[model samples]
Target: MIETYSIWNLHGEQVDHASSSNAPRVDNVKPIVDPNDQVMGIIQDVFPFASTNINQEGEDDVPTPIDSAEFEQYKKLLKNVNQELYPGCESFSVLTAIVELMHGKIKYRMSNLCFDYFLGVFKRMLPTDNCLPKDHKHAQKMLHGLGLGYEKIHACKNNCMLFYKEHETLDTCPICNESRFKMTSQNRTTKIPQKVMRYLPLKPRLQRLYMSTHTATDMR
Candidate 1:
């Protein structure tokens, strides 16, 4: 990796800067999905503005910068960030609990069952004064309320392709032709994919980055 440095001749102070090779790079371009536009169609359905680039007149296709008014709308949507988990709960808010739980899960590599158990225990300990979720389901619902819900996209077990758009009703992988649903004696009627992928929407998350004053300033 290449590196660059600046030195003050008089004071003998030196500062180092990363060269192009060493500097961190972020991919800003939209990802290319299925050639047939199936995945892109699904994404556009969820977020109508996701694929919007050109204006109503179909002018140049480019990213439309968010103005101050648009930013205010996003702020209004996320105004409940400081909402308390329960009435009179000052130590922990809904957002705080969610963040802490997520951090704990990642830091300790906690499983879903383990997370559920801990949440249940915390709920019992706090009694009626706390609104800690009873399990992962409730926590997920809370996230949904805050516009952060994840999408469950069924996928082929053989890593062939996702079941979406034109392939939405297909029972098998288009490429491998493998059975999509696993064999189950108990729930034979209920069709379940052999593998599932969780997709978290990025629009609200991007809006969240501009919610805070410091972060918003940096973003600008």
Candidate 2:
């Protein structure tokens, strides 16, 4: 059976005359998705792609060998994460806790100082053997190592353009003539971007999809 899709403008009006090759320059074309089609998968809960080779120990049964440097780095991280903080609790558990709390803080628009204070409390209350970081900066380092982080890019506050590529070093927005950074206090020297955009690296994430046998087969 043949299925058709509609092109919609920004105002939610259907553009009957909008063709892929002949659509007007001013009219933006957004293709309406088909609910029955796999063109876009069903929206559901966020989950890690399941692997058939996952062992009873909740680890990947098939270990992909890496270079000595990478192996050592993984070994170090494993050591830090596997440490028994207090009886049944491993240091990795604390890391997950920090991750969940940070996720909630961002999701709920909680205060940064509040989150840092909570982390400080965890550090003080938990066993000294626990590998939980002291603050968001250290937590970010651990998350980045685990491939769960994003890159920050500076952008124009008015959304005129991104401060990327050839525009990377510019101090002001060429289109709007607006300052790229906000005015800071005389005592402070750090130049903070007027606005920032978070970007997730695609390479590692794409590789991870193929690691799952089902996802790999589906992709093919």
Best candidate, TM-score: 2
Instruction: List, residue by residue over 1-220, the lDDT tens digit for candidate 1.
Output: 2244333334664445444246678869988643223322322333333455676898857664656654453343243345667787666566557656866887999998999999888888875876677898777655443345679988999888999889989998879989999988985788777999999899877776665333567887
Best by lDDT: 1
* Candidate 2 residue-wise lDDT, 1-220, digit = tens: 2245444455677666635557447767788743222101211001222113478998777644446655554544444444444556722344455555677889988787887888889789987776668887777665444444578989999999999999999999999999999999988889889899999999877765665444777767
Clashes (backbone N, CA, C under 3 Å), per candidate, total 0, 0
TM-score of candidate 1 to 2 decimals:
0.51
- Measured against the true structure, the TM-scores of the candidates, in listed sequence, are 0.51, 0.53
> In model 1, how large is the Cα lDDT of residue 141?
56
Q: Could you tell me how far off, in angstroms, the CA of residue 8 lies in candidate 2 after the best superposition?
A: 52
Pairs with backbone N, CA or C atoms under 3 Å apart (clashes), candidate 2:
none
Question: Which parts of model 2 are misplaced by more than 4 Å?
Answer: 1-72, 87-111, 127-130, 185-189, 212-220
